[model samples]
Target: MSADQRKSPTEPQRGNRPPAHGRRRILITGASSGLGAQLARIWADDGRDLALCARRLPELERLRDELLDRHPHSVVHVYQLDVSDAEATERVVERAVVDLGGLDRVVAGAGIGMGARVGSGHADVNRRVLTTNVIGTWNTAEAAIRHFWDRQDGHLVIISSMAALRGFGGAMAAYSTSKAAIATLGESLRSSLARRPITVSTIFPGNIDTAINAGNPDKKWSVPLEVGTAQLAAAIEAEPASAYVPRRPWAYVAPIMRVAPLSVVRRLVG
Candidate 1:
């Protein structure tokens, strides 16, 4: 018999099938705490396998143990990773894929926020924020996309902020620019992979009570961590092109924020 004739119709053709959605094997960066950790918990509760990475080993391990205790059937791998390190990011992503059997989704959730006003002579602080938020996100995305391309099925989730809608002056300038860059990166990747099965989703979250914004009095519209992360996980699973978390105000607010005058922005956000 010819090789073509020997093929079974029941067997799926290579690179033709879309990624499985429910109970997915997911890898998340910055999974030690905040939104990342919350996402891990939500997925774990649903009996999904998770590969969690963060610089804080103790926190990651603790989270893993908690997940395992609650859902003994779930598989959780913990890795001490700093997404800013390009080489380490690649290596950890590959390792996670191996450990998880395969990857259905990757969340580039690692980020840092530091106050840096223009001409404040705090170049180091500004640089750190940019490196962690921009370079780190790029490193994670690059590694994840390479694997997704090989598998021809994967979802990439990027965590951006509502601040990305426009340029913010003062201490928020660096953070706003970094988040804008991330959103653009996700959008560009989505366009580049338009023909493929790979999915790219950028999440624009409004204020959430994560450690990053802890003690910040300026966060007027903050939601609880649980509420924000739950909504975020739903969006990530849906595989939408883009989303605004805590959709009520932010979904309505994002459009106006985009076209609002600088004076209005300053009054509203400042």
Candidate 2:
């Protein structure tokens, strides 16, 4: 079967019905740049309606103008949102659903990648990472779930990381932990709503050449922004329960990390 033809764990039985087609209404967070922006573009190319939000309104507006220019028929709405604020997240989600008419899928993609070594006087960095990655994801998921449950059908796409596969030391510790928590959150929702039409997909992405990580000297095994986001968009359309983008190495690497020695894992991260 084609990649998009594959069914997710929470997808209804094959004979029951097929996946939805035509213009999809999608809401994406952290869409100012990086993977989030690319995903929006991919969907827009398919003439999909989108509600995009990020802390940066100008960036979102630029994206909106670009999308409108490219796909005139597509409806694109931009909102300024900081997913870390639970109340704001909920309000924005509700408004987006209204503005877009309805939401078929919601992508939790807003996240930060700050470095702070353990026991280093920089506990603030760790706290910020946790708040933005974990709590922010939860806030987005909570809002999406309530709306999806009411409609009895929707897809929730959580952007996790390959770092979630194993624990890391030093600066990566908190970030790794946050990714793991969100992955678990997606899985838990997937299990709970298995019998329902609501689908939850957790995506574990490897190093992608986004603006956030552009300066990192270690570009080892990293895919370009376009390639990574294209794969992500395909996976989201497929609605897989969980996936590793540019799956080649990471799909195989994830399991190895789970069983590898602590020293080996440390070296791998370093």
Candidate 3:
């Protein structure tokens, strides 16, 4: 709720967490590609054990083998998870926690960027986006935070977006809406759990040419995949209530987007 809750370039606030390079157990949803996959690589290289989940079991296995091949000592388990299925999400998360012996962090990173114009008669696309991005995230959060609640210790990170600072129209409508909801959800969780050791963080990533953002209008300015996720891993390590990946411009740009005139917004984003 306070302005300081959003991290600044220097001295970003952190929570009770493992040491910067400590080896710990982490679980990540949507680990098949893009941000999730890259984050796995970054952390694996740091010697952390991981539980990687996504709809694509094959890709998960491939990533698991690759990480294991590179870091022979790290333990990586892959689970086929479709976070939209609440029951399955709960089951798989519990199982993954069991497999990993325990969980130290969970990243609810599963999401889709599909959308349709409000009046375009493509209700199905809009529904899919809301269900996958919003509901799917909620399901993952529900299961993960429940586990953390039991121990009164853990970190939950939601991958939000800079798009959340505004309500985009056209193909970005539902995606932006979902990200806005995620930001608010992370803030609410952080507030509710303030008295506990559990740390809830929200990461607002800038444009990257990931599968979910094929239609991003700002794609040309996208940070390279490895560069963006490396920044993401650093921000997550800090465990801020909220953060912008590659904080230089976004740490400044996000605030302006929140209050800028719609005309200016249209010219900049649309």
Candidate 4:
């Protein structure tokens, strides 16, 4: 089957779930740059309270100042944190929940990617990508889940990738698997929390023009950083279980992988 043949996330029907209010407190990880930074700006511009976290203190401080200057009435809290460390992740999240008086949304956006062969004796690169992309995301999501469980009203936006549409080849083994794990994690959470008021949306974006792709030869999938971020924010507002942003292109790609023969997939990956 081609990607277009697979199921897509449609608008939720017959429900009165309203979009999160502009004043809602939102927590975003990896907010130092790229998509996370864009999301932070988008939320801030909407007049929402924000808790931004990343490992870089200077960048976080500058972003905080920018947001505060732009939206004086909006509360912007900055935390310099490494989400890969579970303890630190917990501490920062605790402060965010308390300082913001409970989070209405959490964007688990802290992730890393690589273009190295797995098991090529590059232990450092493998560990860095896996830790930041998968484990870090897990830690952030777990913290958000706990907080949302308590409040019973919140949103979780987990960012996966289109590379995850199939096992990534061309020097992306670990990166692809990590994203695939993210997609599954979001799906599992969606199932587990079906009865709750919390909404979980898993976003699979195509090639976005971020630092992640900074040094690579330009590819056809590139979309500006803002485009992907805006699509994500819109997806959050739409509140579906899963979505392929820049839907026209990737919506066709996702389903095709599902029914394709294994050999064909391998060849495609090659």
Highest TM-score model number: 1
Q: How close to the true structure is residue 46 of candidate 3, measured as C-alpha lDDT?
A: 74
Model 1 global lDDT (CA atoms, 0 to 1):
0.85
Query: TM per model?
Result: 0.90, 0.89, 0.90, 0.86
1-270, model 4: which lDDT tens digit per residue?
A: 222211111221111222256427789999999988998888777767778899998898788777766655456778889999998999999988877778888999988877578667786886788899889999998899998898788899899987777776546788888899989999999999999998899999877788877666635567788987898788777878999877867788668766787567555423
| Comparing 1 and 4 on TM-score, the stronger one | 1
Error of 3 at 116 (Å): 1.2
C-alpha RMSD in Å of predicted model 1 compared with the true structure: 8.7
lDDT of 1 by residue, 43-120 (tens): 877767788999999999788777766655456788899899999999999988777777889999999877689799
- Tell me the whole-model lDDT of each prediction, alpha carbons only: 0.85, 0.83, 0.83, 0.79
Q: Which candidate is the best by lDDT?
A: 1
Model 2, CA-based lDDT: 0.83
- Output the worst ten-in-a-row residue range by lDDT, candidate 3: 5-14
Name every residue pair that clashes in candidate 4.
2-256, 3-255, 3-256
lDDT of 3 at 27: 92
Sequence-dependent TM-score of model 4: 0.86
Misplaced by over 4 Å in model 2 are: 1-23
